[model samples]
Target: MTSMPVESPPKRATLRQRVFRALSGEYFWLYLLLLPSILILIAVILIPMLFAFQMSLGNTSIVVVAGRGSINNQWVGLQNYLSLLQNPSFWQALRETLYFWVVSILIEITVGIGMAALMNQSFFGRRIFRVIVFIPWAIPTVVNAMLWGMIFDGNNFGALNDLLLQWHLIQSPIVWLNPSALFPQIPWLSNALSYLGSNLAMNSIIVGDEWKTLPIVAILVLAGMQTIPHEFYEAARVEGASAWRQFRQITLPLIAPVLTVVLILRTMQLMRAFTLIFTLEQFGLPVLSIQAYQQAFAFGSFGMGSAVSFLIGLIALIIAYFYIKRLYREEL
Candidate 1:
């Protein structure tokens, strides 16, 4: 009897065959789907970023002249960065930017978390209240800044001073816009604290910015709160857990991730804060963005401005990397 002929095993797919299969499969569809976004990002973000890096490496004058499109610039590698590092104004601006970022984000998180907790409760008109809280956020940044400027007007026309005077809060209308009176003295503190009163102008801007952006943090936190299962709270309650205990044990840990996200986002936003501060009080208080603007446009030192901008960008990247690492560690 003739035995059944043995069948040969199927050959392994060649590299070209695998590539052909992938091109005809789900991966190809995904690549097609992502093509438009990738192209747009290259055109809008990547190309400009590369060009800006090139500009930062050279002394590109930003001055606009009729019939002249651009100024001739000489390549001077790292000179702009070195100059910015040694510049007193750059240091001052960097300090002020960090101060604003830290102070504003702290206030925002504190107030935002409080508001989120309050809003999460079942209350009449809660929806309406949420909308009201977001009104400043809904308004354009320019309008928000302008509105605050009007309210903080140092003269009789100022609404804040008007209310304060009506309530007998201040002896006289305070000069809110005066750079000389920007920071108030902390009489109890010594040395640098006393000198740090010069930050009142920046502080005022910080307050305005916090008002506009606090709702964003609150909303994010509220979303986080929603993700927490009610059963967890119910179980804790059944276990005789106090409200504070429940929050500390259950709520805080769950919400910490969202808070980290809020912190990173707020830090980035405040680091590059421009429109509000520029509109409300231009050059009165210097932050990094304002400094970059002054260097690039005011003095036509595009290279130095670009260097400062890139430095701030570097800081943002570092912070983002740190938090992302923390996020991964927490997951582990």
Candidate 2:
């Protein structure tokens, strides 16, 4: 056979060229569609988050100086984290935050489930009742906190105290915000339990937060409840199943998905609860968000504050992970 010139395969594309081609290909429109959102997310979220992380690794002076429009980038590796670990205040804040979050969520879920159930049923003036229930959810959180704070004011003339006094519930007005007054002299309880005093300030804030947010959960659950078929309940009723049994077997399982979603969203929100507590109890209850704010603004310790913030985020992530896992398990 006659000799023929040999040919080499075309050169492989570089990573950049491949990426460019991919972006320029059939998905070009998709990439173009997403470009603005990506840029906005980078500008609004990722950049600030990374910058905050960088600041968390530095000294307080870095943030203080930077706030003044100057740069004094002094790197101090892990010292702030270490100090937070050693800080009693951080632990106390974490403990209180966990307690408050758990208790608040429990109460909110109970109230929300009840309200949602009632709203799901036929009743007189139900539309007006729903509007009233939803009004709190529409109110600004700060305003709700302020309203509750006034209601629970330490003064004898506070709304709740005045009501109680009028009802002959107490001889004198009880200072609901004062720990000492809330607990009095409970010898049986431990110091922490007694000192915390049903966490009056914290619980007051929790109640306010719950009041403002409960309607949201209820509405979501109601939406889910509406999706459930009437046939299932009718069949259960035909089988002579009691109301509680029907709720336990049918309503709960049918609504589990919605409850899970509501739980996760509420968990995340409650974990970072700040505005309500800040306006109502201030730092009287040492929750992590409150501590973070106190550290950043009150004490001007930005590094520590950033550490506290990252820690809170970490806790929220962990909690979300478990809840998400539960969701997955249920779906499976």
Candidate 3:
């Protein structure tokens, strides 16, 4: 029996058809609208990122000891990465950076959620209080760092020191900025913790960085909190639930999604906390971004700087990928 010839699957769309489909669909206009943005992003971000990766592989004249005047594009072939791996200072800096990032982000999330809850509640002058709390978030990181830097000005005349002294908290003006001046000679920016001590001098300065950044986390949480409905709280209240109970049952689950998104976003953001760290320079505290800057700019080691930058960007990309992945999963 002659079977009917099998119908071939419809011919696959050409590159042109694929392009047309992407450009003509509901979001196709959006794609068209966003084409420029994507192009710009590639041009401004991706290109530089790739170029930095290439630089990381080469020994730039800036960092290496070379003979005669010339751009030293020596193809070192992973020596830079090897040197980075072997360097004790790099490890120390990495340790310090990890500690700083983890601690600050944990505090920011906790405080951010608390602040968001407070803002979501009914209170007198809530608007004003929110404005005040949000002021820091609105301020530029450089400005916030500058402001805090002045407050901890390593002098008695600094705002915080002045206030503390005025309150009779101390008979003498303590140099807050000086590492060697802490009660037990706690190192501030001038030294690293010698051994694993529960309390380190670097902790004091990191608090400044935390203060400057926590408000940003809080603002993001507040935006999340606002999306939650009041009906859930009201429903819980109708059942004679305790405030804590209401929070646990009603607020927690409802804001969990927001919390997740905010956590990831803020995690990525805090990871790139370079500007604040740079401005609040205490040589003792070497966070990743600060280390990158010092390597590239101070030492003029472009290859090393490129390596540092490449690693940072790699981190940011991973976080972003996971963030978007979770978001997609939730949506589905």
The candidate that achieves the highest lDDT relative to the unseen native structure: 1
**Predicted candidate 3, C-alpha RMSD:** 4.6
| Counted clashes in each candidate structure | 3, 0, 2
- In model 2, the clashing pairs are none
Compared with the true structure, all predictions reach lDDT values of 0.83, 0.82, 0.71
Q: What TM-score would each prediction reach against the true structure?
A: 0.88, 0.87, 0.80
- Return the TM-score for candidate 1, rounded to 2 decimals: 0.88
- Candidate 1 lDDT by residue in tens digits, 150-243: 9889987699999999999998998776655432354445335424433556667777888899998999999999999999999999999999
lDDT of residue 177 for candidate 2: 64
Quick one: ranking by TM-score, best first? 1, 2, 3
lDDT (Cα, tens digit) per residue for candidate 2, span 2-22: 989889899999999999998
Candidate 1: regions farther than 4 A off: 1-24, 62-68, 180-191, 194-198
Clashes of 2: 0
Please give, for residues 1-332, the per-residue lDDT of candidate 3 as tens digits: 99999989999999998888877888777887888999999999999887778788987755234554644667887888888879987776666665666677678777777888888788999989978986766777788778877887767888877998899998876655443423355455224443322123346556877776677667777777778788877887888999989877776666667777776766666655676556666455565667777777888788887887667667767866876787667557
Instruction: Count clashing pairs, candidate 1.
Output: 3
Model 1 weakest lDDT span, ten residues long: 189-198
